[model samples]
Target: MLRRAGLPIGPAEILAGAEALSRIELGDRQQAQAALRATLVHRREHFEVFDQAFALFWRAPSAPGEAEAGEVELLDKAPAAARRVSEALGGGASPAPPKVEARPDMALTVSAGEQLRKMDFEAMGAGEIAEAKREIRRLALPLAARPTRRFRPNAAGRRTDLRATLKESLRQGGEVLDIRRSERVVRPPPLVAICDISGSMARYAQILLHFLHAVSNDRDRVSTFLFGTRLTNITRQLRHRDAEVAFEMVSHIVPDWSGGTRIGEALDRFNRDWSRRVLGQGAVVLLITDGLERGGPEELARLAAATDRLRHSCRRLIWLNPLLRYAGFQPKSQGVRTMLPLVHEHRPVHNIESLRSLVETLSAPQSRARMPS
Candidate 1:
């Protein structure tokens, strides 16, 4: 129950918990709960989850089917936990059929939903990962439109188009008729995502790819490339409306799915081949990696050079590092030190909340993004 709730519980902890239960009086729930928690719980952050799961799994039934809560307002979570408890305690079959259907569409309570938004991608269970995928697909990456040097025809624009006016008047025997106007082209900037798919980043990579797929289908001029030891452009593959088909296609084409990290080599390849092609017209670049270079100082120098060039080419070079979620984080790694001073913004991307912050930053004005150096 604790493991399913995202706690780092293991067989040893389970054995210790069973021994504690043996020593405690089973009739006194308080002693049993405390002893079990003392053995089972590992981290401070997982305490609330343990408490909720314990209460839901062990409390006596409020109604006929053990679905209702004893005192807590954790209604929706109770049903699933109750069902899991029933399976764990009553074998595969329930002691009595649940009278309440516990509607399949019953949405998670506000607290549980918020907890999921704040949960780390690495700590989530399989069920939470599926739920996170559905949430990621629905995210809207609406960038703030910026004006370009190019002009477009508009009836009520402030700028008068003398050339267009003359061209129009030529058809009327060169006589002045209605005035032609023009407006500066306002458009969403291009988005180019360079994501790491190394073994260390495997958990975050899968979820982020779903987000990239959504962005690819939602907007124009969005490019996605995955990198481990090599860089693979999966932008075209993600254009398919069906996500599963698109992912399968990406899997077939990308040679290095979960391999060693060669951050510099991959970025150098991208700079040589794809940068000029995609980083035009005020492009916003998202460099998603943990900045863990595999090679020595020479490789770090190459990463720095490639990153500096990339900074010059793109309008905004934002670094999204999952390692930034750690408390008291520092640029101790060679790769992190090489690239930190070059990026326009450094942000964490380990949870949905951080992604929401990214979406907001992308939608704000250009001046809102801060430069690191």
Candidate 2:
């Protein structure tokens, strides 16, 4: 009831209130008990703390009388008082709590930081991917506000609107003082993310999907997609108020789970279909994959060329390769070598720290030159 009455009471406050009640002197025990009970229910605010204290003080088993036992049972069965209080406080019925669906306990048990150095990307499964994605979401990024150009009325900056200020001064009894001008500050560009979810990319997809969900909800203007043999737009699905529901929807939509990858075909389709649509307003593309092309080098080169075209369209193009997690990583594959040169940033997407680094890179300006042809 206190919560309903908009009174914030912690556990300590409830206990303190109970203690104070217990200490009240009784000239007549019956009268004092009646007065206390009346005080407890005088208002909703009183009932909230009183209910909690009563439950604690008179354990159902110890409380005397049939009425007291019935009250205790009612309290035990009381449809979570917090929800009622919240509703009464004008918050409405509390939102239905998320359903916790039980999945097999198949989570990977890698010790923190111990496996960061030697973790192999190819070895992780769906369960590990989910946990890894959660871990990645926990990683923080150093977000720096972009420099904005604000308009100023003073000649020291931009030209002052002398006419408006003089008019205002005249309106203030001809006083040529307290002149004011307005300025518009430019907002920083929104962050754009384009993630790849394809066949060979399936092992890394779940974690990245979680990462995409986090980015979508936490930041503004995020676009996501999944592609195996074909491209499936998942931007709308990830917009569900609940992340789990969004992902479940995505899992249902994406048909090529653990299927074959066609990087060139997917990129070509994206270039034709989504690039002009979602790639506008200075977005960043995060092309994630191992860069193994079954379509051979020609198609890989064509996709690489399209990726380069995408690079021109966006503020940044980053390539996140799980293969880069290997200490002795090399761009031996033709597809990798072809695509690497086109990206503005290249980083590993294997673990939490790597994801953290990716966020940091997104915020900072890159200094590295494009990889040599």
Q: Tell me, by lDDT, which candidate is best.
A: 1
Best by TM-score: 1
Cα lDDT of model 1 by residue, 309-334, tens digit: 99899999999999989988989988
Model 1: lDDT to the true structure: 0.82
Model 2 C-alpha lDDT per residue in residues 1-373, reported as the tens digit of each score: 4433223333544565576567766565545445455543433433544454434344455445764555456446543443333334343343585875965354755554556423443333233334565666665543444434555554343546677778888878989886566554544454545555544565467667777777777766667877777788898888776878998898788776555678777888888888888776456678888787767657877888788787887777778888787778888988887887788877888766677767777677644465332
**Which 10-residue window in model 2 sums to the lowest lDDT?**
1-10
Lowest summed lDDT across 10 adjacent residues in model 1 is found at: 82-91
Q: For model 2, what is the alpha-carbon lDDT of residue 267?
A: 80
